[model samples]
Target: MVLEAAVLYVKPGLEKAYESAFQQASAIISSMKGYRSHELQRCLEVKGKYLLLVEWESLEDHTIGFRQSVEYQDWKQLLHHFYEPFPVVEHFEKVDLT
Candidate 1:
């Protein structure tokens, strides 16, 4: 599995609106291929900061499969305007500890 993370800095005074938009946007992403699950976490200390985490079956399932799909455009249209400077997304894989 691959983990996708992003630190979203929403525009000031738009936190509630952003959350609402994200609720709508979530539907778009969850329906995509290889999508396992996702989360949106609000920061305790920061006023307009959120952490977004998404799980995919593979890297291509997200980077290419999701990002390249028509659904991505819907996702962007619903949630992209809420960011201040835009978030940088990164992917990770679990390390074996055994």
Candidate 2:
């Protein structure tokens, strides 16, 4: 499985709004092919920060399949504006796990 991680720094008081939007946006992504699961976590110690972890079957599933689809535009519209400076997303392959 491929893991996609993003650390979003929402603009101060927009954290609640961002979380609400993410809940709505997540549904769109979940319907895509090869999308396994995802979790949106808020940082308790660091306010306005969130960790988004998404699991995919392959890199192409996200890059080519989902990103290129029309739904992605809606996804961006819903979630992109909340970021202060735009989050950096990185993909990883599972290496060692219990």
Cα TM-score per model: 0.98, 0.94
Model 1 stretches astray by more than 4 angstroms: none
Candidate 2, residues 1-98, lDDT tens digits: the string is 99999999999898878888988998999999999999999899999989999999999999999999999999999989899889989999977877
Write one digit per residue (lDDT tens) for candidate 1, span 1-98. Answer: 99999999999999999999999888889998999999999999999999999999999999999999999998889899989898999999999999
lDDT of 1: 0.95
Q: How close is candidate 2 to the true structure, as a TM-score?
A: 0.94
| Candidate 1 lowest-lDDT run of ten | 73-82
Clash pairs detected, candidate 2: none
Task: Give the Cα error of residue 61 in candidate 2, in Å.
Answer: 0.5
- Quantify all predictions' global Cα lDDT against the true fold: 0.95, 0.93
Off by over 4 Å in 2: 96-98
